[model samples]
Structure formats: C-alpha cells, structure tokens
Target chain A: MFIDGRALPAGTALEADIAIVGAGAAGITLARALKDSGLSVALIESGGLEWSEEAQDLAAGELGPQTYATPDTVRLRYFGGTTGHWGGWCRELDAIDFEPRDFVPLSGWPLKKAEIDPWYAKAQSVLQLGSPQRYADSEGIAKAAGAALPVARGGDIEPILFEFSPPTRMGEVYRAELEQSAVKTYLNTTLVDLRVGDDTRTVTTLTLARDGGPALAMTARHVVLATGALSNAQMLLAADSQVQGGLGNGADQVGRYFTDHPILIGYAAILALDPSAGGPFAFGDIAADKRRWRLAFQPSEAYRAAQKRLSCLITIEPPGPRFDPAAGAFDRSDAKWFGAPETVNALAAANATGPVRLHVLNAGIETRPNPDSRVTLTGKRDRFGMRRLKVDWRLSDADLEHYLLNLGDFAKALAHSGTALLRIPPDAAARWPEETSWGHHNLGTTRMGDDPRTSVCDRDGRVHGMANLWVAGSSLWTTPGAANPTLTIVALALRLADRLKAEMAA
Target chain B: MSDPVARAWAVTRRTFGATLLGALGLAAVETWPRWAFWRGAASSLDALAGLPQAAALKALGRQAQAAMAIPAGYADTLAARLGDEGYAGAVARDRAEGRLVSIDGWLVPETQALAGLWLASAG
Candidate 1:
C-alpha cells in the first residue's frame, strides 16, 4: 500500500520489520527482493512518484572545492531515484578492483568479486540486460561487427565491452508491482534523525518529517540506509542527536573517502592511416545478438600491476558522421552530435592524401582513495530540518599523473601496432580536475571493510559498531572502478537482501 | 667517422631507383600506397644527402633532439640508424623506446619529424 507522508498526521507513528530510506535503485531493489520473505517492508522516499521542483530543491547543497555537477543535479530523489535519467551503461567490476594492491592505499573490498558473482548474475535481469553472457562475449561481438579489435600482442591495453540497458526506470516499470505488493511505500518522507536507546548500539526509533511538518516516528527491527553515496553519508553525519559525532561515526569515518570516476574528454587525438585502422575501437555501436554493445580499451592487468596505475577505460569518437551499419556509410544528418571538431578538421585536411580516419579519445579514470575527499554536514538545513551536505570532492596529484602515464602507454601501443598515431595535447596533464568531467558516480564515503577506523560498514553491509543499521548502494564501495556503478548497486542490494533475510531468521 | 653523405643516406641510389620504378609499376595496379609512403621518406633523405655538411638538416635535427632533451648529436645518430634499418625499422625502434613527439598535433617518430623539419626548412 502506498501512503503519502503529507496525508499522515503530524504525530503519527508506524512500525515495520524493515525500513528502507531513499527508494532509489538500492532501496527499491532491496524492497522488491524482500517480498514473500515474510518481512513487512516499508520504503520511505523523499520525493513523490514523479519529480517536482520543490522536492529537487531539498537536494541542494554547498558546492565543493572541485567544479562538479551541483549536488541537486547529480542525483534524483523521486521513487526510482537517479535511474529516472540513467543512461543504462552497465559492466561488472574487475577482479583486481576487489583485491588489495600494494600500490594503492585504502583500496580493496571486504568481499571478493567471486563472492558477489552470483548477485551480479541475478542483477542482470533487474537491469534489463538481455543476456548475462553478452557482457563477456567481446570476441563474438567483434566478430559480428565484421572487424576484430586491434589489440596488439603483449600490448599494454586490452579490449573490453559495455552492455547497455533500455535503462529500466524503476518507478515506471515497477509502479504497479509496488502498488500491489505487501510492502508499504511512503512518499515525500525524509529521515531526519536516528534515535538510539541507552546502549547507543541499537537504533530504536527513526524520526521522519515531510515539508516542514511536525516530526513523525517509525520503528523498525532493521534499518537499511539505501540513500545514495552522498546522502548516505550526509544522513549519517546529520544524525548527531544521539551519538556524539553521529550514529556509527565513533572513529570519524562516516563521511570520508568520497570518490567518483573523473572523466577526461578530448584528451588526445588519433590519426589513423585509413578508415579500417580505426574500425576496431568502437567509433560507433557494435550490434550483436539483437543487443547494443560498445567496445573500449583499458590497461591490461599486467600493465596496471607493473605501472602501479589506476583503472581507466579509453573510448574513441568517430570523425565526421556516425557509422550507419545498414547503409554501410556515414550518416551526415547525425553530424551535429559529433564532438571533437579539431579531429574533424585534421581529417578533412588530410582527406586528399588518403582516406584517413581521425578519432578523438576520451577516458574515464578512477580516482585514488583520499580521506580529504569527503562529504560533511553544512550549517544550513533543508525543508525537513535536516542539515544540508557540503561536498569536498578531490583527486590526488599522483592519480592524475598515473592517468597521464597510462595514456602514454596506450599511445605507444597504438603506434606499435601501426593502427594509428596518438597525439596527447601539451596541456593534458596540467588541465586536470578543471578540464575533467565525471561519470556522476558518487561512491565510497560509507565504504565497507573489516576495520572500523577506515570503514563505516562491515562485510555484510552492517554499520561498523551498530546492530540492525546497514548501508546499501555505491556508498558501500571501498573502491570505485571505472565501470558505471548502477549494476553493482543493484547487485549489492540483492546481496544485502539475502543477508538481511538470514540475519532476521537468526 | 663515415662520410657525412653516406651516413645521412636513408636509401642508396640503387635501392631508391629500383623502388621508384617499382612504385610507378604498382601505381598502374593501384597498389602503390605503401611504396608511396616510403618514396616520400626516401626523397627527404635524398635531399638531405645533397645539402652542405653544415646545412639546416643538422639544425633541425638539433631541434628534434631538444624537444626530447636526450642528446645534442641525435641527428647524426638517427640519420645513421635510419640508413642501417630502413624507414619501417627505425620507426619501430622509436615506438619501442617511446621516442616520439607531437608536432602540430601529430605524433611523429623522432627520426621522421627531423626529416620533415629539414624538408620544411629547405623549402
């Protein structure tokens, strides 16, 4: 049953076996997964089924030192969360992403990729991916495209594939299911405080409010903070009434180590000897198995291990017009969408000499974990009387230096294969953090680990010292790999749902 | 030291003559793209071989060396290496050693960039 928080009386109180805050990808997935498990679930969202200006205003916060997408614009607060505008780019994290690397500090996840492989497989259906096998079939997809990726032997780069989703909008797709399910959906409700009992370990009650109304109360046997990476930490840090610092923030590790994939566009230009030379690099979409896939290149595992570099994926943009597979020609009508004008001009100038293809290269590289990159509570309060967030996103100088070195390695590999010659702009390194855009993937902050000092959650997604309080979503990620986080977010949510069922039974 | 002219020679006259005829023959069959690329490089070497000992070729060579800050006399060393290992071989070596520079937004092998700079200066 759906209940509008506005309709409830100011002093109303409710109870449930599980209370999930923020009905985004993680919250909805967890709520849906818990169905028929004999648990009475309550999903509390900060917005209505549809977006409104007033609800979006609640997402406003002070900007950080880095020029990032405004906090209000980065995430949505509605029923489906940010999946309302998601692009549906999905890929699982690499095995190395979960391992502890000697070169990277504050890295490694408490759970291994092998341990979460089943959840990722199950998440493929939730993400609307046609086939789970399609993601790993790079060779088959390349064969279907009639051109193999130009990966040279012993080269520092390897080809990878990204599968797309019709981008299942959870609110629109699962609205009827949610409406008919046993779970209670509360809209326009914001979690303001987490009240703990005398022990201060168990969260006995939750204070919620709606649109400047009087605070209401809800008690749950278990509480899962399914808010996004930014808000998860923001909500935890803002709940300082009970705990001195905040709930589960004894060591001051609640809002630190915030991370996102820093994107670099037009970082380098590629001049191919001919059109076929650039064909292997997914200048356009590769159609296979009646699904769309894109090919990109990343540093080989050996290369990263040897060079001590972070994860990065490089994509190529075709010059002139997009390639039309059916017509087997460039679609000039779509030329307006093409980026990298300099590459187009370069190719146009060289058109007479030969049929050369120019390509602009862009990269999405991981940021190293830094304690200074964090989210903290601001002095100002939102309409719900909860403190606003102040994000201070940062990237270390060493991370940027490693990214440039990785680009250099990719350039050499391309040249060595005689596929193309890559030219990195003179100011590529100096323009970082300013010229960089983002994947809009807010991650870490409430990172999971075995140690309480460094992480906010444990291996099973529970808070470090608190019982019955868990964190879900990208905020539990210890390291954000270069892949998009939505798939993993849902995967981890399903994993957390199983854990919750087991814990409840125990 | 060997004769400056011989050391600077990228292709011997006999090889250049044979390749020029071969390139013309292949052009009739529309298969001269590979040779056409090599012919341009060979022609640049031919021009460098004809210049004076203290010509602009040496100055352009120094410029290329300064971009990488390796050594001062790389022009002669690269010229000699280009003579010993053909155009493809020398370029492969430069790629292996990461000795390439971006000239006007084009990544050029150090040896090839020096030759192009010399040709531009000569013109």
Candidate 2:
C-alpha cells in the first residue's frame, strides 16, 4: 500500500517490523525482497511518486575545494532515486577489490568476493542482465569478426565486459511488482530525527516530517537507512541528541573515507587500421541467447596486484573525421588529438578506400580511499528542518599516478603489438586534463567493516552498537571499484534482506 | 693564365662541377625504386610525371617535410645531450607545448634530408 504523507493526520504515530528510509535502488530492492515474508515493512521516501522542485532543494549542499557537479543536480530525490537517470552500466567488483592490499591503506572488505558471488548472480537477474559470462568468453564473436582484444590474458591488461541494462530505472521497472506487495510505501515523508533510547545503544523511534504537515513518528523493530552515501552520512551526523556527533558514530567515522571514480579524458590515442581488417580495440557487439554485450579493457588482477595500482577500465570509440589530420588542421584549443603526421597519414590511408577504421581511447580510473575526503553537515536547514550535507570530495596523488602509469603501459602494449603506433606526450603524466569528471557513484561514507573504529556499519549492514539500525547502499562499500556500483548495491541489499528476514522470523 | 686567382677559380669550378654531378647520380640511384614503383602503378613515367595529382602529392610530401623540419645540427646535439628515452621525452614535451609540428606520414623533425636518406636505404 502506498500512502501520501501529506494526507496523514497531525502527530500520527506508526509502527512496523521494519522501517526503511529512502525508497531508492537499495531501499526498493530490500523492500521487494521482504515483500511476502510476513514482516510489516514501512518504506519511507522523501519525494512523491514524481519529480518535485521542493524535494530536490533538500539535496542542495556545499561543495569543498575540489570541483564537482552540485550534489543537488547530480542526484535526484524522486521514488526511484538516481536510478531514474542511471546509464545501467553494470559489472561485478573485481576479486582483488575485496582483498587486503598492503599498499592501499585501510583497503580490505570484511566480506570476501566468494561470499558475494552468489548474490551477484541473483542481482543480475534483478537487474535483467541475462548471464554472468564474460563477454570475451562468448564464442565465435571475436574469431568471426576479427575484433579480438589484443591485451593478453594474465598479462598487464585483459578484456573486461560491462552489461548494459535497458538501464533500468528501479521505480519504473519494479513499480507493478511493488504495488502487489504487502509493504507500505509512504511518499513525501522525510526522516527528521532518530530518537535513541536512554541507554544510547538502540534507536527507539524515528521522527518524520512532511511539507505543510505535522510531524509523524515511526517505531520499528528494525530500521534501515538506505539513503545514499551523502544523505546517510548527513542524517547520522545530524541525529546528535544522544551522541555528540550522531547515532552509531562513537568513533566519529560516519562520513570519512568518501570515494568516487575520478575520470580523466585527454589521455588518448588514435589507432589507424584497415576498414576490412578490424582492429582489436574496436567495440564488439555479440547477441547471445537474449542479451547484448559490449567489450572493454581492464588490467589483469595480477597486473594490478603486482603494480599496486587501482582498477581502471578503457573504452574504444571510432575516431571522427574532425580528428583526421587530412581533413584539415584543427585548432589546438579545441581538438583533443596530437595532430601527428604518422597518425594523420594512417587515418587518411585507412579512409582512402572505405570507411575510417581508427579507434580513439578513453579511460575510467578508480580512486584510492582517503580519510580526509568526507561528507559533513552544514548549518543550513532544508524545508523539512534537517541540516543539509557539505561534501568534501578529494582525490589523492596515488589516484593520478595509477591512471598515468596504466595509460603508459597501454600505449607501450599497443606499440609492441604492431597493432598501431601510439605516441604519448612524455610529460602527459605530469599534466592532467583540465576537466576532471566522475560518474554519479557516491560511495564509502558509511563503509562496512569488522572494526568499529574505521567503519560505520558491520558486514551485515548493521551499526556496531545498535542491534536494529542498518545501512544498505553504496554507502556501505569499503572500496569503490572502476565498475559501476548498482549491481553490487542490489546484491548487497538482497543479502541484507536475508539476514533481516531471519532476524525478524526469530 | 699565369694569375693565381684565376687558377684557383678554375680549380674551384671544376671541383664544384664534379661534386654536383656525383650528388645528382646518388640522388637518382636512391629515388630509382620509388620512381619504378610509381611507374608500375601508373601507365608510364611520362604519364605519372605530368599528372596534377602527382604534382599535388609531391607538394604535399614537401609540405609534410617542412612541417617536421628542425634547427641545423639540433638532432645530433639532442641525441648527444639526451639518450634515446630522454630525446623521445624532449620531443614529446616539445610537441605537447606546440613547439613542434607533426606530419601524418613522417615522425616529428623528419626533414627532407632525412627522407632522402630513408629512400637511399629503401631498396
């Protein structure tokens, strides 16, 4: 049942077996998983069914010194959450991402990759990604098309694949299923304060507010804060009645170690090849039983471990005529190409007989977690009277070092393979592209770990001191890999659902 | 006939004439393969020589060489001061700074003189 919070009577009190704050991807997934478990669940969302300007204003926050897309603009506050605009690029986090690396400070996950592999397969079905098979392992596509990836297996670089969704918006995709479920969804209901008991170990009740309405209270056996990394940290930091900092923040690590994938664009090369004879780096499409797959490149696990580098993915796109030197000299101010004669000649020759078969490179790099990068509460209040978030997103020098070193390795590999001659400006490592961009992957604010000092939540998504309070979302991620986080977020939510169900059943 | 300046002029002219002839012979020998290749692709040497496309291509080649030109003896100095890696690094830095222009067919600093040397060894 879906209830509009504005229509409720003033000072209403609600009760439930579980109360989930924020009906986004993680919240919705968890709610769906607990649908028929005989547990009365309250799925509370701040926004209405559709987009509203008032609700978006709540996301307005201050940004730190580093440049970023405004928090309000990058994130949406409607029922489905950011999945409403998500590109649906999905891949499982690599095995190494879960391991404790000696070089990376505070880098291991309490849960192993093997523990989550099953959940990933289940999540694949939830996201509608057909199978878990690697795109390169798809038989005959590479051999028949002659578009094999040049990077050798067990080498410095290897082929990786990202399965695209109809880029499923969770609200749209699961609305009908949710409508039939027993869970109660309250829209336009904002979680205002977490009322902790006198002992200060457990949350007794949650205060909620609505636009132009009296406050509401919800008491639940279990409370899951599935609000995104930013909002989750904001709320925890704001609920400072019992604890000076916030609930479950004894060590004051609620919002520290925030991380995002920092993307750099200028480091690129154009590979010239015959139109008839396809290049190894070109995007390959394969139709398997019912799924469509696209191929990409990533460094092998051994390579990343040996080099002590973060995960990175490279994409190949067809070069445009504008990038062709023979077309005419481009203004250095506008063009990304280096305008090398050999490159132009190669492009011209490739286009001489038929279509141009040149490939351009783009990469997405992973950022190592830094403790100083975090989300804090600002003095400014939103319409619902909750303090807004202040994001201090940061990227370390190691992140840039990994990006350049891997890019240099990619160039050397291309040159050695005789696939194409790659010329990298020697000091390309020293200079970064002016416009550094990122995917809207908010992660690591309330990371999961066994140690209470470093992480906000335990491996089961429960807060350390509080037995019933939990967090479910990318916020629980210990480390954000280069791959998109939606599939893993859903997988972790489903895993949490099982634990929650068992606990409720008990 | 007995004047020393006149004798010197005569000797210089003779030596200059011999050097010019020898250089022309070497150039012809070096370019023979390229000429032959073009001849085979085209109908004949005369047919290829007079075509506007041939002239435009030659002009384009010259333009490419000009774009890749560097200072006199700069390559030797660079090669000496910087090893191969350092030289490549310097060249890359220069190109990035817009101090060097890159031609499509040739590497940076590929002058017309280098083209001649490459052609001589092409056979």
Each prediction's Cα lDDT score?
A: 0.78, 0.72
TM-score of chain A of each: 0.93, 0.93
Q: Distance (Å) between predicted and true CA of A6, model 2?
A: 0.6
> Residues A1-506, candidate 2, lDDT per residue (tens digit)?
88899899997889999999988889999999999888999999999889999888888999998888777987789899999999888888888999888888889899998999888989988888867755446234455455665655546876667778777888888887877789999999999899988888778899999987889999998999998988999888999977798988899899998877776655555443223335564464544445555666787888899988888888765554544566763334323344444434533453443333445566778887788999999889987888988889988777878876787676655443434434354445555533577787889889999999999999999988887899999999887778889999999999999999889878
Model 2 off-target regions past 4 Å? A135-146, A274-281, A284-289, A320-334, A339-358, A430-434, B1-123
- Report the number of the highest-DockQ candidate: 1
Per-prediction DockQ: 0.12, 0.03
Clashing pairs in 1: none
Worst 10 residues of 2 chain A by lDDT: A329-338
Score candidate 2 by TM-score against the native: 0.79
> Candidate 1 on A430-459: residue-level lDDT in tens?
777787789989998899999999999999
Quote the positional error of residue A87 for candidate 2 in Å.
0.3
